[model samples]
Target: MLEIIGVGVALIIAVFLVLAARQPDVCHIARSIFVAAPPERVFPLVDDLRAMNEWNPFAKQPSVRNVYSGPERGVGAADDFSGDAGSGSGRIEIVESIEPAKVALALRMDRPMKCSNRVEFTIAPQNGGSLVTWDMKGRQPFIGKLFSLVMKPEKMVGGAFERGLADLKTLVETAREEAAQ
Candidate 1:
């Protein structure tokens, strides 16, 4: 009986390893929304880390703390988030900032796992408003690949992006309307 149990556990472990090995080396998640405001009107919200946290769903999560460093806003600006709950410890910094159109960031996770990722926010003029897209791309570490075997990483991570985008849409659109009035 003990031998059978050992074999079962071994088999499960073997299968998990095989599946994890088969997982993609890269992971990409993207979410987008349209705000009833021009790119210029919406640019500041994303370009500034402080303004972004106002609409960032992750920032609203309980137990997360953020420390600002480098610069107040724009390129070279960094935010080091430290905490044990929610998304864990990470450092996020703006790598590129293009006026009223695009902002790119580097995200480095320190705890729970270690991996470097890229985040991009793009604003484009469309349908009388701006089409905003947020994208994250990263190389999956071994643990991340293993975790993906039992979870859908895209849905798990993209859901936050979706919520953040919704909040951003509401904030920008409401501000736009108020400014017109």
Candidate 2:
């Protein structure tokens, strides 16, 4: 009876670990919104950390809070966020900028489960509109890899990214439309 109980407990733990290891190698989420205005106008709304609260999907939710630091509207700007277990806390810094051409940021976050990830956002001009891509890349720790056997990372986070992007597209485009009129 004792042997059976130990084996049962071990099997449960193994199942949980396997599930966590199968996450994605590169988790990417992007959405393009064509503003009647120029990239210069639309990009500013996204490039600024403080400005994001106005349209960010997470910002709309009550569980999250964002604090800004560093510069005001350009490179070196940073924002720290904390929320529910899933939301946790993280900081983002503007890493690169080329005026209306491109802007990029580095994202580092500490999630609830004690997992961490690195993320980046790249914005580029395309046909008078802007193409904004949100990407996250990180390696699973040894234990995380083992967990992946049961859970695929991409599958786990990809849906959230997709929804977030869709919401962003709507927010930016609507704001731009309002400004134009």
Candidate 3:
């Protein structure tokens, strides 16, 4: 009986390993929102690393500590942040920046998962407002692949991205209205 049970457990583990290995090497997810504000008003929020703190929904934890480095805005701009286990620690650097159009970021996540990802935000003029899209692409680690088998990474992270975009829309639109007065 014991031998049979051991063999069953081994089989399960082997299957999990195989599934993880079969998982895709690259992971990409994107979310977009329409903000009732122009590109000029939306560009600085993402271009200036420090200004990001105002609407960055992910690192809102009270324990998160952030240290900025390199240029304050545009390419080479970066920030390193550390916090509780959930928030973890990571570094984000702007690798590409085009005024009122796009900003690409290099993200290195160290604690929860050790991986490097390319994050980009693109802005497009639409109906007198701006359409902003956030995209994150990375190679999947073995551990991440294993976890992916249980829960998809896209679904897990999509909610945060959606909420962040919504928050950003509200913030910019509200400010635009107030400024018009």
Candidate 4:
């Protein structure tokens, strides 16, 4: 009976390894939200890494420590973060900033794992508001592919992206309302 159980577990492990090996070497995940404010109003919030704390779900964690460097709102800006187990440690730098239209970042994560990725935010006018899309893409090594098989990067990170966008929407709209008062 014990032997049979061992064989069953081994089979399951083999199947998982096979699936992981079959996964793509590259992965991409994107999520978007429509903020009730114009692109001009929403652009600065994302362009400034320090201001990102106002809307980034991960930045809100009590255990996370964030450090900002370089210019406040454009290329050369960067942020380094270290936090609890759930938060990990990473550095994000703005490599491209297109003012009210797009911002692109290079992200390097260490601690829980070492990986590099690119993130971008594009803001476009739509229906009197702004449509903001957040995208992340990266190269997945064998280890990363295996981890994705278990964690499913899209569902894991994509959920965070969705929440961040919601927070951004609320932050922009609330600020706009307050300014009008």
Candidate 5:
């Protein structure tokens, strides 16, 4: 009986490994939203790491504690976070910024998993407002690939990206309205 159970477990592990090996080496997740505010109006909110706390859904979690380092905005700016499972722990640094248009970040996650990823935000003028896109991309190691077999990276992280963009839209549009009054 014990031998049978051992063989069952081994078979399951083999299946999981095979599936993981079939997954793509690189993973990417992206979500976008349209805000009823111009790119200039929406740029500052994403450009400054400190300002992210105001609209970033992840930062709103009660267990998440954030600390800022480097400049207030532009390259060298970073935010370090420590939190519960819901928020995880990571350090995000602004490695590139292109004013009212693009911002790219280097993300290093420590807790839950140790991996480095790239995050990007692009703001473009559209219909008098702005079209904003949030993107994350990274190379998945064997362990990460195995995890992806259980939880697709796109579905797992894309939802949060969508919610974050929604929150950003509301915040920016509301501010735009208030400013016009």
Candidate 6:
């Protein structure tokens, strides 16, 4: 009886491991919003790390003390930040920059889950405003991928992205309104 129970437990463990290993090791999500401001105006805001708190919804205080390297706010520029556990410590390096169009960032985060990802912001001029798209992509370990499946990273993070975009629209639109007035 004891031998039979042991074999059953071992089988269950093996099956669970196999299933976990089969999960996708990569995931990505994107969210976008249109702002009643030109890409040129919005582009500069994204380039400046110090200004992120103004638009980043995930950041509660939105303010962070960071060590910076490279240019003030362009390709090769990087900033290091240590925040709360949920916020984590991380560095974002500007990997690509195309004026008023696209900027790609390499993000490395510590704590919570140690991972690196590619985050990009793209702006398209449209009818005196701009369409902005925020994209994120990362590859995870088998175990990490399995965990995300249960936790739903897209739903968790995507909601924040949506809010951030909405806030950005408000900020930019408000600035435009003030300028016009």
Model 2 Cα lDDT, one tens digit per residue, 1-181: 9999999999998876666555554344444443444567666766777776666655556888888888887788888888886566777778876776566777676775445455555566777776766666665676556645655556666655566666666777787778779
Candidate 1 lDDT over 1-181, as tens digits, reads: 9999999999999988998998889999998999888999889999889889899887777777999888777999888997764678999999999999999999999986788999999999999999999999999978899988777879888999999999999999888789889
**Residue-by-residue lDDT tens digits, candidate 6, 1-181:** 9999999999988887787788777779899998988998899878876575568865554444577888988898888877776677888889998998998999998766788999999999998889999999998887677677578788988988999989888888898899999
Clash pairs, model 6 backbone = none
Candidates' lDDT values, in order?
0.90, 0.66, 0.90, 0.93, 0.91, 0.84
Position 180, candidate 5: lDDT = 88
Question: In candidate 3, which residue pairs clash?
Answer: none
**By TM-score, how accurate is candidate 5?**
0.95
lDDT of 5 at 19: 88
Estimated TM-score per prediction?
Answer: 0.95, 0.71, 0.95, 0.94, 0.95, 0.86
RMSD of 5: 1.3
Best candidate according to lDDT: 4
Cα lDDT tens digits, model 4, 22-89, are: 99999899999999899999999989998988889888899999889999889999999999888889
lDDT assessment of candidate 4: 0.93
Writing each residue's lDDT as its tens digit, candidate 3 over 116-148 gives 999999999999999999899999989989988
- Residue ranges of candidate 6 with Cα displaced over 4 Å: 1-19, 61-65
Q: What does candidate 1 score on TM?
A: 0.95
Instruction: Report the C-alpha displacement of residue 57, candidate 5, in angstroms.
Output: 1.8
